[model samples]
Target: MNELLSSAIKALGEKFGGQVSEFRDEVTLLIPPDKVTAAATVLRDEFTFDMLSAETAVDYCPQTNPRFHMVYIFYSTTLKVYLTFRAHVNGDDPKIATMETVYPSANWREREIWDLFGIRFEGHSDMRRLLMPPNWEGHPLRKDYPLGYEEVQYSFNFDEIDVRKPKGVR
Candidate 1:
């Protein structure tokens, strides 16, 4: 398995001009934005990685160009192997082609990534908020987003004597 993964990664790096940073039994293909869909297709069809395990995004803010990333994890029943691919996008304009055409299960996962990270999944049949309420404002998962919370006060025993803070502690 390791040997096959290595050979695949090597061939991909040579053909696609990507840096094969990590490869074990599961191959990790770090791809550029323009080649993401093509790379995914190759992995799914040629490499026999058919299953779409997950589609998610990662924010790497405060970095140079393309500070965010979207990851896709695939598993192949025929090959009995796993493969991962990543595509980087500008934090300000985080958008990428949807894999739902290739793997229908990606519809919800892509929508989730958009709802959380604001990563637009182009070509997604229906893109909407999956976890957050419909009226929610910002993408809560973004690094720059505030935690939006408010403090609340409650009294367990109103009948009991009122307690006051120590003289100087107030």
Candidate 2:
């Protein structure tokens, strides 16, 4: 890690008592859902991580205790480095504090996560679907969501499957 990120990690550990882990040289601070907003605030106000580069969610289906991991990436223009942190949310009713207040750009990213992953963002100014229709039934990105995959047709089954597929004339 570079000097800036190293020092930022140290400061974060001291502030939040977060669990730090590394993957491919990238450091991630695993924080509880409750402290996520506070951590983001500190990262912005104190660490000079002025940009909320990205905010997204990951669903761990079939595991309920900590079902979702909300990932936030921050970039510091002054320091020229990136830092990532994640908040663990319960699967039963996954919810996390919003960072849009700290980083205005987070508004859309948070909405996307809420729309596709079914993760709620508390204190979000306007939480609504970004890509999906307003009345869409369920979050399509979740692992538990139906695949809706169709089988491919081969030469042997071409004639049989072709009859079921809609035909078009050009």
Candidate 3:
């Protein structure tokens, strides 16, 4: 597994100038957002990574360069190995070319990332909210978002609760 991963990383770095870094069994390649589609094509064609297992994102609002990162997990059925490709984009304008062309399953995954992390997938067939409501204000998964709670209406008397009621008392 490590041998195949190293070979794949070497090919990607040589072909697309990807910043290949490995941590344990996971090999991450930091590719440019604009080159994402092309890079994915190479991975699929040359590396035999035909299955796209998942597409997700991480919001690093305070990062040095690109504050937003999109992660694509792919599996090579022939090689029986896993590879993860990551592309970085500015959080102010988080955008990356969609890989839906190469992997049809990326459609919904990309939508989920956009809905939760505000990472925009350009050229996606159906870029819509996958989880959050259409009228939702902000991306909840973003790290910059406040970790606060909304006030809830209590149906029971709070004064009576001071009597040490059971936890599940309704």
Best by TM-score: 2
Model 2 lDDT tens row, 71-124: 898899998877889888899888888888889998999889989999888899
Compared with the true structure, all predictions reach lDDT values of 0.76, 0.87, 0.83
Better of 1 and 2 by lDDT: 2
* 25-136: candidate 3 lDDT, tens digit per residue: 6888988778889988988887789999888887777783788778899998888888888887786777788889999999899899889888778889898999988999
Question: Least accurate stretch of 10 residues (summed lDDT) in model 1?
Answer: 158-167
Give the local distance difference test score of model 3. Answer: 0.83
- The TM-score, computed over Cα atoms with residue i paired to residue i, of candidate 2 is 0.88
Best by lDDT: 2
Please say which candidate is ahead in lDDT: 1 or 3: 3
- Give the runs in model 3 whose Cα sits over 4 Å from its true position: 1-4, 148-170
* Residue 115 accuracy (lDDT) in model 1: 89
